[model samples]
Target: MANMSMTKTPIAEQDPKVRARNFKEVTLGYTAEQAVEEAKRCLNCKHRPCMSGCPVSVRIPEFIAQVAEGNFEEAYKIIKDTNALPAVCGRVCPQENQCEGKCVRGIKGEPVGIGRLERFCADYMADKPMNIEKPEPNGHKVAVVGAGPSSLTAAGDLAKLGYDVTVYEAFHTAGGVLMYGIPEFRLPKSIVQHEIDNLTAMGVKIMTNMVIGKVLSIDELIEMGNEAIFIGSGAGLPRFMGIEGEGLVGVYSANEYLTRINLMKAYLEDYDTPIMKSENVAVVGGGNVAMDAARSAMRLGAKKVYVVYRRSMDELPARKEEVHHAQEEGIEFLVLNNPVRIIGDENGRVCAMECVKMELGEPDASGRRRPVEIKGSEFTLEIDTAIMSIGTSPNPLIRSTTPGLSANDHGCLIVDENESTTKEGVYAGGDAVTGAATVILAMGAGKRAAAAIDKYIKSK
Candidate 1:
């Protein structure tokens, strides 16, 4: 029987005060009992709208039924049938906008804690290793660019099809954004490593520090005997406001800051990575990246961290859970404000920032209310460090080097309906095609492109 409870079981977590000062994970995963209880809440809707909401189309009811039956290992198998990174996706994917959003239980009250249960199943399997069978080699080879979620998903899928899959990552680490972009406190690197290890166990070869464009171009890969290539090189080019003092010594982009702390091991004292010890830091923007920056700044010894968003709280594009966590961790939100310029001292170091108050006006192209500047409402804020978290676009390295690969005006790769690019035998997906997006969406793109690549290769 369904739990029939309006309220959901609360997952344990670190204390806000303690977590704010440390780099440890904030939300401790659900216990086995808690996971079982949460699974019982799934109504097992005949329509399975929750599965439809998922980008990778995970069989929701089937997995939930296994969980409800106390067969977590079976549930993990069901999830793995479609999703490659359940643990990471369970933590970071915007469930509010996706699977959980279409939950039947959520129609009247709280949704079943799907993410929590998924995490439980994954963690359970991790603790007790399960035997997995490797597919026989199909004698075909495919090259995947970038070891991020998208490329990793495609690599896993192709490897399962008995193809020789190799993932090329620019960074020294395997996981691209999963290693450099996302914080360990949000999605632990160990978990990501475990997932990557599973992929490697399946005969998927991962070569780190392999910059496709510079080290080996697309032409070189084909000549090297790779059958097809899938570009999942994500958007890593950080966008910054063209304002005075932006080049100040204490300024940093969210990507650079997170990379240093997450990938470079700057958060630890033993590591030699240099990171700013800002006393008063301000992160500009309101999305999840902005929250990560603000929270990271706090852990990096910032006495005060401020989020300067141009829109109101309701207009915030970040996950509601993230925003709430930020608030609980003592992050001050200065909403309805936009930065105009950063003020610096004579030594070219940031000292303060000038901002203008904004009000909601007409809806913009993004369907969100346009923030209009409130004239004569400019003010100054005292800040030692300024971190820009506005947004990012795809890096032009591969696109610029690869011939016949067309990109849009914004530098995003243009692909056909089959995720095939202008160049034959090549396909692109994820943030490389669409700007910064969710991990699930990127994985979906990879899955689609993998099918297209397989079909394209067979036709040859």
Candidate 2:
């Protein structure tokens, strides 16, 4: 029976001005007492629809029941059986679009705060001493490219099944997008490092600064004694609005901006090399990445920040919670507007931007109402920096060098449902296959590919 008197507890966050000036965790997590109360909101339903909503099918009701009884360790055990990176998932995942969104309680009142409870359980588990049992050597080696969520999931799973796994990453460190693409405030790098450490402790070999196509092609991997290959290399190329003056000094692609700050540690001035610093900045797009970039820019000391999206507020693709957080942190939302061009000053630095008003029209191919430009509604806004968060694509380095690997017209690799490429034993997934997509979805693709590669190697 549900506690009719108790509703879900809303998680609190940091204050606007203080958070804007520094890079620190914004959302304070639920305490043990609050977590138990939140867990009690679960009806402990029989059908378990929430489980179906999760890509990894976490045991939602079981975990909730355990938490409701103050059995945090038991709850963690159930979630970890299905997910390798529960803590990370609990924080950044779009539970509204996934697990929590399907809660039966949500039909009447607020959904059981599944994400918060999940975080609680996972965090509790992280605090405890872990004695994970490692699988004995299966006498075969598998190579995984890219150490993002996808590669990490595949590598962890493969290692558990006793296959020797070596993960090759392009960056100086592992946890590709998690460490660099996501801000430290949303998901602390320590949590990401902890997850990677779990894999490494399980005997998964990680080689950093090893770009597969550049360091060694896919064919060479097979020749070098790899039984099978999983290319979880995510989409790394940034897209722009194709507006003029994008090459101006103060203009940055969200990819570069995030990479410079998150990966290079530009926030810790003495640790990282120099990167461009701005005062007034505008970020173009509505996705979570755009919000992340815009918020990060403010923390990097920008006086004012703007989120410029072509569509209306209802059409924003970022998680509702994140969008709300951005607004709460004082990020200006300039909806129903589209940038036409970036204006530059005499020194070739970004000075301002020219934009036009847009109106919602009939639904387009993506099912969202298309935005139409309004004639004579053009205007210009002054700003020191502009960042394009429009979208991203697969990098062409591997596709161009790896023979027999066919990519779609957009250069995203075409793979089977099992994530097998045209090239034998060379499996690919994540954004590298689907272009820009949700992290969980990319991880789902990686999980499927890992299973397929496991089967392929065993068959041989």
Candidate 3:
């Protein structure tokens, strides 16, 4: 029988006070009983509206039904059939805006804890061996650029179709943004590595530190007998406000800051990487990256960390859960405030920032209310370090090196609806084609490109 509870089951989490000082994961995931109860909240709606919102189209109701029955391994299999990274998606994917957002139960009360249940099932089967049979090789060699969500997803799907797949990643590590962009507290590195291991076990070959454009061009991969190439290099180039004092010693881009703490292991005492130790820090933006930067500053022992945004809380683009967590950890939000310039000390280090108050005006092209600057409302924030978390664009290395592959004015690779680039036998997806986006969306693009690539190779 379906559980008729109006509200979803709540899961356990670390205390805000304690978790703020440590780098441990914040959510403790659902216990088995909790998972079952939460899963039961699923009405098993015949229409299955929740599945429509998911990028990779995981069998939402089917998996939840299995979880309700306590058949965890079965549930895991159902999720894994479509999503290659259930564990990573469960923790990081914005369920509130996706699966859980369209849930029927959410009409009157809280939606089913789909993400929580997914996480539970993944953790339940973590130690169990997956008896997967490697498909027979099809003799078609495919090369994927960048070992990010999209590339990994494409590689996994292609391998399942018996294609010989090779993934080349620029970084020494394989997980791309999953390893270097996100902090440990949100998504553990171990979960990412385990997923990568699964792909390798399926006969997917990964070559790290293999810069596609620098080490070898796309034409070279084709010359080396690769029948098809998929680019998922992602958008790593960070955007700045181009304000004064941006070149100051203490000014850092969110990408560089996160890379230092996450990939370079600067947060660990055992690691030799150097990082800035500051008492007061300012993060400029209102997206998830801004929240991450602010919360990370707090964990790094900053006495005060402020999130400066030109928009109000409602206009903030970050996930609500992340914003709430940041508040719980004592990160201050300076909404409706825009930074105009950074002030530097005589030693060329950041000492403060100049900002102006803003008010909401008419909606802009993005449909969000445009921020209008308030006249003579200038103010200053005393911050030793400033981290710019505005946004990012795709790096131009691949486009500049590869001929016949065109990119839009925004630096995103142009692709058709099928994710096929202008260059024959070459496709691009993820952030490379769409600019900065969610991991699940990137995975969806990769999955689609895999199908397209398969058709192209078989037709040839």
- List, residue by residue over 434-458, the lDDT tens digit for candidate 2: 9988778877887888899889999
Assess the local accuracy of residue 12 in candidate 2 as a C-alpha lDDT between 0 and 100.
73
lDDT of each residue in 1-460, candidate 1, tens digit only: 6688897889999999999989889999988778888898988889999998999999988998999889988999999999999999889988989999999899899988888888888888987865767889989999999999999999999999999998999999988888988888899999999999999999999998899999999989989889999999999999999988899999999999999999999999999999999999999999999999999999888999999999999988898889999999999999999999999999999999999999999999999999999999999999999999999999999999999999999999999888999987889999999999889999999999999988988888
2 or 3: which has the higher lDDT? 3
Q: Which residue segments of model 1 deviate by more than 4 Å?
A: none
lDDT of 3 by residue, 119-149 (tens): 8888898889988789999999999999999
- In model 3, which range of ten residues has the least summed lDDT? 1-10
Question: What value does the lDDT take at residue 281 in candidate 2?
Answer: 92
Tell me the whole-model lDDT of each prediction, alpha carbons only. Answer: 0.92, 0.90, 0.94
How high a TM-score does candidate 1 get?
0.99
Per-prediction TM-score, please? 0.99, 0.98, 0.99
**Candidate 2, which segments miss by more than 4 Å at Cα?**
none
* Candidate 2 lDDT trough over 10 residues, lowest sum: 1-10
- The better-scoring model by TM-score among 1 and 2 is 1
Q: Where does model 3 exceed 4 Å of error?
A: none
Q: Looking at model 3, how many pairs of residues clash?
A: 0
